[model samples]
Target: MSQHAEQAAAFVLHSRPYRETSLLVDLFTLEHGRISVVARGARRSGSARRFTLQPFQALHVSWAGRHELKNLSQAEVPQVMAPLVGKALLCGLYANELLQRLLQPADPHPRLYLYYTYLIQELQQSADLEGALRTFERQLLENLGYGIGFSHCHPGCYYQYDTQQGMIEVTADRGCYTGTDLLAIAEDRYETVDVRRAAKRLMREALAPLLGVKPLKSRELFIKTRRTA
Candidate 1:
C-alpha cells in the first residue's frame, strides 16, 4: 500500500544531487521521522522547489511513496527563519548530522522535532554557541533515553561520569567535576566557562557510544575550519 502526506511540517536536513536534474532530500518532519524524498527537477535553475527546500526554513511539504524513498510532490515555506552564519551555521549542520546519524527513520519524535526547531532559533540568535550546543546535545540524549543524572552528590563533592555506569562519586583529585558545576549544568546554567566546558566533556562521553565508529563529518569540518582560521 502507498502513503501520502499533505502540508507536513518539515525542514531539510540535507540534500544531494540525483539523476540528471533531480535532488534527493533528507527531511526531518514533525509528523514523521527522518525521511528521504526525491525532489524531481530540483536541480534545474528555474525550479521553485529548489529555493524553498533549503535548510533553516519552516516548510509545509507533501509527499507520496510506498517504499523508503518518497516522491516530493509539493513544498512551500510557511515561515522563513533567520539565516545562520559562521559558527551558528556549523552548529546547525552538526545538529542535522546528528539527527541523520542517530535517529532511525519513520520514528516520530514530536518533542525532539520541537526542540530542534527551538535549537535552530537559539543558534541563530544566541552568542553562547557552546552553551547552545550543549543544551541541545543534552536534550537529544535525554530524549533518546541516555540521559545523565547530576543529582547524586552534594555541592562540595566531586563526581565522574561513566557512559556505562552513569555518574559516580569520586575523590576530589580524580573526579571529572565538582558537584557545583554538575548542578549548574543540570539546571542549564551555562553562564560560566567552566560549566560550558564540563557540559561539553559530559556530552562527548555520552554521545560516543551511540555514534560508534563513524565520526561526525560536521565536527571534522568545524575542526578543519578552526585550524585554518
Candidate 2:
C-alpha cells in the first residue's frame, strides 16, 4: 500500500525479542543475502510475527527503513519445507550460525542460497550425517573463496597441499602429499573408514585457513555426541 514498502523472498534465519513488543529478525533473502529487520509489535501474543518467524520456511516479506533494522510491514510462509528431524534440525541451526558469522551483510549470493536449499533437502533424506556435513562444509568453504587446490603442478613440479601454503610441487629432496589425496576429498570418496576420516580431517584443515583456531560451538557439541555414543 505504501510507496516505501518493498517485498523480498526470504527465510527467517534467526529471531529474538527486542525491548518489549518488538522483535529483531535475522533474515536470509534471495536478493539481499542476510538482513536484520525489526518487526514492531510482532512479539505480542496474537501478532502475525508469531506465526511467521519459523526458521527455514519460505517467506515473502515487506519491510521499509533506512537504518540497519528496517520495519516489517508484512510476513508469511510462502512454502513450508518437510520438517527436519532430530540432528538434522541442529545441523540446520549450525548452518544458520555459520552464515551469520561468515557472511557480510547485504551481500547477495544466490548460488549459495541454492546450495543451502539443496543441503536442507539432503539433510532431510540423508542416512550419513557425517558425510553430508563434510560435503556441505567443503562446499561452503569453496563458495567463500577459500577453495582447496587439488589439481595441477607448478611448472615441472608436483606436490600436495601443505595445509599452510595450499599446494607445493614435488621435488627430489622432499616428499609431499599428492593431488590424488586432495582430490579424493574434493570428490567425497569416503568409501573406506580411513578415507572417510581423512575427508573429515582435510575439511577441518581447509577450514582452519579461513576460520582460524577457534572451534565452532555447534561442531564441538556434535563431536561430544559422537564421543559419548
Candidate 3:
C-alpha cells in the first residue's frame, strides 16, 4: 500500500478503543482492500469524528503514515442513512468479520468492494437476509480465487465438494449435494427450501478452510440471539 491517500471512498469494517483517547479502526477502502488506521484522539468526548467512525455508514477517509497501521488524518460520513438495527445489524457485523479475516491487506478487490457495499446497503431493507449473506459469501470466495466450481456438474447427478478439487461428481447414495441443488446454486436460484439449505451448507464448507479453527464471534452472537428469541 502507498504511504498516504486523501479522501478515499471507504467504510468502517471494525473499530476498537486505542490507548486513552484514540481508536484502532479497520477500514475497507476501494483502493486498499483492508487496512488498519489509528484514529488519534477520536475517543475524546468533543471529537467530531467520534460518531463519524462507525460501521454501516459511508465515508471519505484520509490517512497517512509509512507503516502498515496508518494514521487517520481525516474522515467524514457523507451518506448517513438510517442505522441498521436488529438482525440487520448482526448480519452487518458478520460480513465485517468475514472481510477482516479473509481479505489480504492492501490487495485491491474493486469488484468485491462493490459487492460488499451492495450487500450492506441491501441488508437495511432486505427481506431475504440469509440469501443476501450467502450471495455475498459466494462473491467473497470467488473474489479470493477460492470459489467452488460447478463446471463439471450435470443434471440428475449427485456431487460433493472437495477443498482441493472443488465440486466432484459422486453416486447418489454418497453425495452431500443433489444435482438439482447444485444446479440451483450455480444459477443463484433458491426457490425452494432444499436449495436454500444446500446453499447455506455449501457456503459454510467453502468458508471453513479459509476461516480456520477459530469460530466467528458474530455468528455465535447471531445464533445465541436466535435461541433466545
Candidate 4:
C-alpha cells in the first residue's frame, strides 16, 4: 500500500495513552475509514496536538505509514462541535465504541462517515436521543451489509423478529414489537414511546451477532450511569 502522506476529514473515535507521552488514537476518516495512529508526545504538557486531538469535532488530519498504525503528523479541528454532556456524552461514546468495534480498518465508507457526523450533531441537539441512536444503529448495520429486513411483516398485524428468520407474523407475543412498530422503524419514524422502545430492542437483536461475546465498555458505562441516577 502507498505510504504517501494524506490529509482527510476525520473525527477521534477513541484514544488511549501509549508508552509514556504518546497516544494511540482511533480515527474515523471520510476518505480512509477507521485507522489507528500514534500521536507522539501528545500527552506531554505543552503539546498543542493534545488539545486538538479530541472527540465530537470535525478534524483535518494528516498521517503517513505503510503498516496498520500510522504516525500522526498533524491534526487540527476544521470546525467546532458543541460539547456533548450527561447522557448525550455517554451516547456519543457508545457510537464511537460501535464504530471502533464494527468498522473495518482502512476501508473507506464515505456514506457512513456522513451518517456518523450527522449522528453526533443529532446527539447534541435532538430531543429524541433514543430515536437518534436507533437510526444510527440501523444505518451502521446497513452500511456494513447487515441491513435488517422489515418488508415481510403483514401490515397492521403483530410480528416477531427472528435474528435468523427475519420478521415472522406473531400468533403470540414472542418479541416486543408490533407490525406497525416495525414498519415505523423501517421508515425512521419513532414518534411514540412504544415504537422507540421496540426499535431499540430490534437494533440490539440485529447488532448482537456482529458484536460477538465482548460487551461494549461504553454500554456498561451507560448502565452504571442509569443505575446511579
RMSD of every candidate to native, in Å, equals: 1.6, 3.9, 2.1, 1.8
The alpha-carbon deviation from the true structure for residue 133 of candidate 2, after best TM-score superposition, in angstroms, is: 2.7
Which stretches of candidate 1 lie above 4 Å from their native place? 1-3
Ranked by TM-score from best down, the candidates are 3, 4, 1, 2
lDDT of 3 by residue, 1-229 (tens): 6564645789899888999999999999998888899999999999987888888777889888877889998897787767888998999999999999999888889899998888887888866787778888999999999988887788798888899998888787743898888888877787799989999999999999999999999999999999999
Candidate 2 residues lying further than 4 Å off, grouped into runs, are 1-3, 153-164, 169-178, 188-192, 224-229
Off by over 4 Å in 3: 1-6
Worst 10-residue lDDT window for candidate 1 reads 1-10
Task: Please give, for residues 42-129, the per-residue lDDT of candidate 1 as tens digits.
Answer: 9899998777777777788889887888999988887777788989999999999999998888788888898888888788896777
lDDT of 4 at 177: 69
How are the candidates ranked when ordered by lDDT, highest leading?
4, 3, 1, 2
Cα error, residue 98 of model 2, in Å, equals 1.0
How does model 1 fare in lDDT? 0.86
Scored by CA lDDT, what does every candidate get? 0.86, 0.74, 0.87, 0.88
What TM-score, computed on C-alpha atoms, does each candidate reach?
0.94, 0.79, 0.94, 0.94
Candidate 4 lDDT tens digits, 93-190? 99999999999999898999998888888888956788888888999988999888888865668877677777767675655467888889999999
